[model samples]
Target: MKKTITAALAVFGLVAFAQAEGDVARGEALSVTCSACHGTDGNSADAANPKLAGQNARYTFEQLLAFQTGDRVNAVMSGFAAPLSEQDMWDLAAFYEAQTGTVGEADAELVALGERIYRGGIVESGVAACIACHGPNGNGNAPAGFPRVSGQHAAYTAAQLYAFREGYRAAEPAADARMTDGESMMMRSVAYKMRDFEIEAVAAYIQGLH
Candidate 1:
């Protein structure tokens, strides 16, 4: 079964990621401060930090914008994102997208549980399958702006999911509803419905997806 899943994922990769162009050299130069947390190669040494390696450029750019615009809030990220111009965001995204992410080992006991939630989901509870957007191997659907999840740190992933669940990504109270995108709402809806165990299990599954 696992072999079949792997075969299917390889085939899907051809169409899933739509690449973007940016100046890699400039991106590398601009990434000096980011290296403190994200590392020079986009792989953070800390499990709590997200690995930016092989991420979709547009997705990364959008996230940086989100941090800047307060669509997504994090004290540290907000400060880091404040000074960046739009071009800087794209360049940084390009550099990180060029790096490879490290795959993590899944806990033997949680592997099956994680796989179940990631692939099939808990329909009775209205939880959607992660694979629907993240793709079979966690490559993510770049054309649709979904970020890469495969090879991500479980701790980081779980934290984000929980944040969304708790309304961390909600638009500012005074902002127009139109400012909220459907994708963000969809993710928040899913997270809000998920149990703590589901978030942890799915995150574990994603770590080993590569």
Candidate 2:
């Protein structure tokens, strides 16, 4: 029994190591293509494009897969991701996640209001705290596959929230597979409750995250 357990543990360790190695190797190779838009270190200089540095690997991977499979639709991203394999997506995500990110400051009034909205949802408005999943500092959990919102551009964040609220942004098909019916319902409900002003406030708060 002891020997059998030992063998099983050894196999598990080897599998884990192999998977990690694969992700790293693939991520580095796939990153070459991403450097054009995302920058060499994942810090995009383009105002229209969000920086990917310090983003959660799972989030990055999921987005890539979504674009490739038509779960998420963006003309540019769809074309870019279409040719990538699963390993390629994983590798690129790892590469971006390994990079460092920069933070920007928010205006005093905006910050104060943003903080109120982010930490305490508007009860009358039926909004929920952004911290429920994004964590207090906006450093999203790797396991949960949430992207890091801290230090993200306010404009970019606001745009994304707006898209989600309008149902213009669809869940990556891969992500939908993992989500339960309840999860989807909650997301739809929460998104519907967010107005443009609320989106701006939360985004401003997120920009201040360091």
Candidate 3:
């Protein structure tokens, strides 16, 4: 009995070690394919692609799953994610989250205006502060599954915000239903309330975040 128990414990230890190693090893390997769009360290060189560096692992994983399952429809990402397994999603998230993000510069006036809007919502317009969930520095919260908005491309950000407003993207079915409802409503409201100039200003501010 003693010998059997000892052997079982040893096996358990090995299994645990392997699991940890798998995450790291798989993350490294999977990152190679991602570099073309997400850059070497998760920053995208293409203005059309959003930067993924410093994004929450949960958020990144969910997005990957969405693309794989056809819940989120992006022509390019759908093809890429279709072949990934659950483990691949986890590993890719780990890799991207581990990288440091690049920051962009914003116009002074736009930054100032964006800062005010981000911190203080337009109450009359029913606009909510972007910082409430995205954090003061836009670093985002992992637990909340909020992707880091800091250091994103201004054009990409504006486009996405506009898309969300126009209902071009549908909510993920697997997303936390409770949070999704509130988030969806807030985003929709904010998008309608914002003008093109406001979107530009906000995007500029977001790009400059470190």
Question: Residue 111's C-alpha lDDT in candidate 2?
Answer: 84
Flag regions of model 3 displaced more than 4 Å: 1-22, 168-184
Tell me the deviation in Å of residue 205 in model 3.
Answer: 0.3
Q: Return the TM-score for candidate 1, rounded to 2 decimals.
A: 0.84
| Candidate 2 least-lDDT 10 residues | 1-10
Worst 10 residues of 3 by lDDT: 1-10
Candidate numbers, best lDDT first, in rank order:
1, 3, 2
lDDT of 2 by residue, 1-210 (tens): 000101111111112212232255556667787788778788877746788998876677667766775656677888999898766776777777777988877756678878988788778879787788788888886565556888888887776666566552445333223221123544446656877777787788788887
lDDT of each: 0.76, 0.67, 0.70
Collision pairs in model 3: none
Candidate 1 per-residue lDDT over residues 1-210, each given as its tens digit: 000001111111122322335667788888999999988899998998999999987788777777787766677887999999877887788788788988898877778989998999888999889899899999998666788998899998888887777663444512212122344477778888998988998898888888
lDDT score for candidate 3 against the true structure: 0.70
List TM-scores for all candidates, in order: 0.84, 0.79, 0.80
* Model 3: how far residue 8 lies from native, Å: 28
